[model samples]
Target: MSEKIKIVLAEDEPSLALIIKESLETRNFEVIVTEDGDQAYNAYISEKPELLVLDVMMPKKDGFTVAEQIRKQDKRIPIIFLTAKSQTQDVVDGFKHGGNDYLKKPFSMEELIVRIHALLNRVENNQGSDDGLTHIGGYIFDYAKQSLTYDGNTEVLTYREAEVLKHLYSTKNEMVTRSHILKEIWGDDDFFNGRSLDVFITKLRKKLDKDKNVQIINSRGYGYKLIC
Candidate 1:
């Protein structure tokens, strides 16, 4: 049998942490639960988990600090932030600190499970491939490197941006529904996540705008189509 995927989860709430640990264990994931940010970081370094799920408000260092510290050495280990802070700036700060996804507090365990699977699947697929490269217009996208190169310019992409681009590229010239993209990437299609998706789409449009042939067309209320 394949080895179970390891996870480091940091949540200060005892009851919530226990519930999450039990749920993940039932799913055959090896979960390391910590109640403080300091212990969480230590566990992360020692366990070297396949994924990280951290609560924004934790004792002794907070999720942002932990994520920043981790990102300094590893940019590819998917980190998901869990917090009650839903402000736009807070979400942006989470991304700035190297978080791959964010889940607001009072979130469903099922949603968390789906997000975990989606992120792990993305990372595994890229690692399993011999060459994680894709061509779009005049640009070369390296999935493993999370970068886009064209001409003499190379732009590094955030984890969420890379996942969005990957999905668009895979469905090039075809309409990919917004709901599908949201569920696959953010694990939800709620108003906030939908708005977040729009922000990411705009960022991607600016990044690929140098090539006229590479266009991400919006299909009104339906979805988006990447024409390359």
Candidate 2:
């Protein structure tokens, strides 16, 4: 099954926040909640959730400011605004404030579900296959869902493992030096970092063990290569 859609919700109303949160969770959506606009922005910056739901009137910065800050850096991620204000001016301001969709308060959970699914479907339809699953031996990867399947007994890869695999694929037919992998991914090449890389290489090797022709060649004291 695909991973649950991750949502970051920022609402100041405790009761309403709980209701929305429970509704989302009940639908198997992973949600991160914050009561203030600033906290919401911070969570988004760090987590990079799939979607955002912000309340219009929030503590610390207000929904408009929060949405504006996020849009400044990322224009692709979908955003929705939730509010009690339903006037024409408020609706106009909400869009002007950078929300992809606006939901007036006293909305039903079912409506929220419909809106969330609509946005998710739009994003998915436009998104091409994930870069992570394009090639590996003769098997294709499913990056968004993190699975490797052929005949049966599919294996799931962790986020870090998927990232490492993607980077290695990008360097296919060329040696990816340990130094570069360290700096590019871990941003460190200390003793422990080297050990960590070794561990990752071991795990990746195990995953590709089924295919004998494909190889991740170790360059000994220098780098690694993804050989086809």
Best by TM-score: 1
For each candidate in the order shown, give its overall lDDT on alpha carbons. 0.87, 0.77
Query: Which candidate number maximizes lDDT?
Result: 1
Q: Estimate, for each residue in 1-228, the C-alpha lDDT of model 2 and write its tens digit.
A: 158878999998889889999999999898999999999999999878999999989889898899889866765477888989866566546655556566878999998888777767756764764534476777677666556665566887653465567778879989989998876554446554566567668887888888887788898989999887
What is candidate 1's lDDT per residue for 110-220, written digit by digit as tens?
A: 989988988888677667662567989999998767789999799988766877898898899999999999887776788877777788889999999999999999987
User: Each candidate's TM vs. the true structure?
Assistant: 0.84, 0.55
Q: List the residue pairs that clash in candidate 2.
A: none
Prediction 2 global C-alpha lDDT: 0.77
Q: Distance from true position, residue 210, model 2, in Å?
A: 61
Segments in model 2 whose C-alpha atoms lie over 4 Å from true places:
128-228
Report clash pairs, candidate 1: none
